[model samples]
Target chain A: MVVIAHPAIAEDSMPRATLRAILGMRLQRWPGETPVKVFVLADETPEHATFSKSVLQVFPQQLRMAWDRQVFSGQGQYPEVIASTQEMLARVASTPGAIGYVKASEVTPNVRVLKIR
Target chain B: MCVCSRFAKTTASIALAGCLLSWHTASHALDLLDGDFQLHGFASLTLVSTTDNNLFGQSDNQISKDFSEVGVNASWRLTPALQLSGGLLSRRAGGTDDGGVRLDYGLLDWAPMSSEGGRAGIRMGRIKTAYGLYNTTRDVPFTRPSIILPQSIYFERTRNLTVSADGAEVYVERFGEGGTLSASFAYGQPQTDTEAAKVPLVGLDRPGKLDSKLAPDLQILYEGAGNSYRLAFTALRLDLKYQPGYRDILQAGRFRLTPLIFSAQYNAENWSLTSEYALRRTSISDFGPYFYNGTFNGQSYYVQGTYRLTPQWEALLRYDAFYADQNDRDGKDFAAATRLPGFTRFAKDWTVGLRFDVTPQFMLRAEAHFVDGTGFLAAQDNPNPQALRRYWDNFMLQASFRF
Candidate 1:
């Protein structure tokens, strides 16, 4: 899996924990005050499961519960869910401060690959 | 009196439904204000049955369905540095709650400092108290581990006092390479109008009401190992006064409660373990001979484990214990003096529960408990303390839905 970010993000790499925080909805903004939009495929998808375990190092269900608890409690919000990998790539590439992951072969020049620090 | 409260609850439910129905149209307009505006809600119904004692209704030898919860919340992110959020909640828990539409929280969050390293913010309004891991979302069943929270620390009898407070809070967060660290401090007036709050603070039949002054609540949390390990510490202090009524047996009283809690959890793919310990120092004074006006140190703790039987199924086991007075764990001295049952001052509970997620938006849960005391029982549900038994069994099932 390849982690991708919007073109405007200056840093090409971030700690694994930072990446998890963004996807977990704990960190909401980038350095420039741009809202960090997150995109992901359905939980049941193999690509999504693999990304959640390998990159985020968190269970798929745990992530879902975290989002549910935060959103319902008025403490935080949920990350935007993209239906498929194609949409994930397309949207992340277009939206500023957006971040997502996809198959290595699906990587396009529109988005920059983020290296795990 | 019972039928009257039930009728009022039904009317309130209808009113809540009406608000939700109208929000369907307003939901679209919310986006017009700002694309970031979001509206969310949830509802749940629970059935309870017990071998002895009434819980949430006439649960003794009968299934009681008076337990239900509903809530609606909205948030607008005006900017990265500022946001406005609020929610309304209605809870029906046997006779303890009246099922009225209550404002849960309405707050404005302002963040003046922000960077990749961390951020600092201040919130003013009705802010939810951060007492422990589950206090913030205790009313939301979908976020809870079981139908009922661990009564050891999150006692239902005094929920109004610890649920939420109206005032201001300041918070700071630091995002580090190792983990994330955050802390918050709040000073506010806790809600103390409910009978549930008055019963524990003074007496069950007190004609007067209980009022709370500005209290301070502080909490700090640290998450490490990519969010697998979590730790938290919380300190809460409350000061309350009693306003007497005509010919009331209880005189004007005052109370001070300071509780400190330590929480920890470790999460893995297939299973999780969590435990929390609390030390409570409570002092009551100024009441005449009608009540026990002394200071006592109480203790409570619980250990729980959850296993993922499958992707859609989960199982949980927990041991929760509570002692109203740590030094008087058996309550023998107090029982002999006050003529109350010794077992009433402490509780030992063993629970096993199961959860099934029918879909992302719906869930079903079942749990059973074998309790050895009446310490945590709601006083309103069991008005005649003399009829209480020392041992009891409780079983509950709940179905919840969320948007």
Candidate 2:
């Protein structure tokens, strides 16, 4: 799985820690003051597990706990959940400052693949 | 009678609204400001029973359904750097809390400095206290590790003083490759005017009023390896003053509590381990000759483990212990001085629980606890101290849903 972002995001690559924070919903804005919009597939999805473990190097449960702690405490919000990789691609492509994940083979021209350093 | 009916009406209406919204597939809706506005809520009910002592109600012999929580919150991200959020909670915990609706948290979170590397922010208004790990979200069933948190640290009787405060907090975080380190400091007036808060501190609902000075709380946390390892330290102080009522035998008294807590957790695939230890110093003085006055250092600690048997099922085991005074672990001195049972000063509990995730939005849980003492039982639930037992057993079943 590879992380993808809206083509409008200026940075093609970001530090892995920053990427993790973004996906965890702790980081709310991208550089240049663009509101960061994160999308994710359902927790049970294999793609979601792969993206959380391999790409973000965190367990899905950890991510869920982090979101719950923040969301319930009114410190942050949950990411918009996409139904499938198809919807994930479409959302990331259309939504400014959007970030999501897609299989390497399914990468399309609509969304820009983000590289983790 | 009129106010009671009005409250019932409001609760029924909100519950109806929540049920209607639960039917919507998407939890987030009304995305008014380009999806900046969001609403969420949760409802949970529990059935509790105990062999000897009442908890959250008269649960000594039969099941009691007096424990429930309902909450709703809304947030609007007005700008990338600023957001406003608030929530209302209606909690019923038998005589301690009468299911009254109250503001859980309402804060304007502003991050003047923000970037991928880190962010520093200030929250002003009614902000949740960052106590231990679970205190901030303790009311939310889904966020808790068990149906009832370890009473050793999160005292339900004194919860109002620690749950949230009316004031401001400043926080800073650094997102690094090795881990995430964050720290916060808050100064606020704790909620001490409630009957629930009064009973715990003074041992009864005194006619006098209890007021707290501005309390200061501080916490530092480190999350390592994607939260595989978590550690935290917290320090807090609460100073309270009581003014006696008309013809009141008690003089204007002073009570002070200072607690230092250390918490750690290790989360691994399929299983997790967590523990917290606290040292609390309590002092009460100047209640004329009518009340006991002294200083004591209390000790509390708990170790808990949870294992996931399946993707949808989880199991938990925990050993929690508490002592009202470390020097009098068995309460011998206290019992001799007051003629109260020594068991009231200490508790040792063994708990086992199971959780089933029926759906992403719904969950069911059951737990059983065998307790050796009544140290943590709320006086409001069991006003008669002589009725308490040295040992008891408790069982609880809960159903919770959120959207």
| Candidates' RMSD to native | 2.3, 1.8
Q: On a 0 to 100 scale, what is the lDDT of residue A99 in model 1?
A: 90
Q: Share of real interface contacts recovered by each model?
A: 0.42, 0.62
Off by over 4 Å in 2: B1-31
Best by lDDT: 2
Candidate 2's DockQ is 0.77
lDDT of each residue in B1-403, candidate 1, tens digit only: 6688776876777577557657765653334342467777778889999999998988999999889898888888777677788888888888788778888988888887877677788989999999988898889888888899999899988889999899999999887877779899999999987787888777577789888899999999997766677899999999999999989988888999999999998999888899999999999898989788889999999999999899889999999999999989988977987888888899999999999989876899999999998899887888887899889999999998766
Candidate 1 chain B: minimum summed lDDT over ten consecutive residues — where? B26-35
Deviation from native of the Cα of residue B217 in model 1, angstroms: 0.5
DockQ of predictions, in order shown: 0.54, 0.77
> Candidate 2 at B274: error in angstroms?
0.2
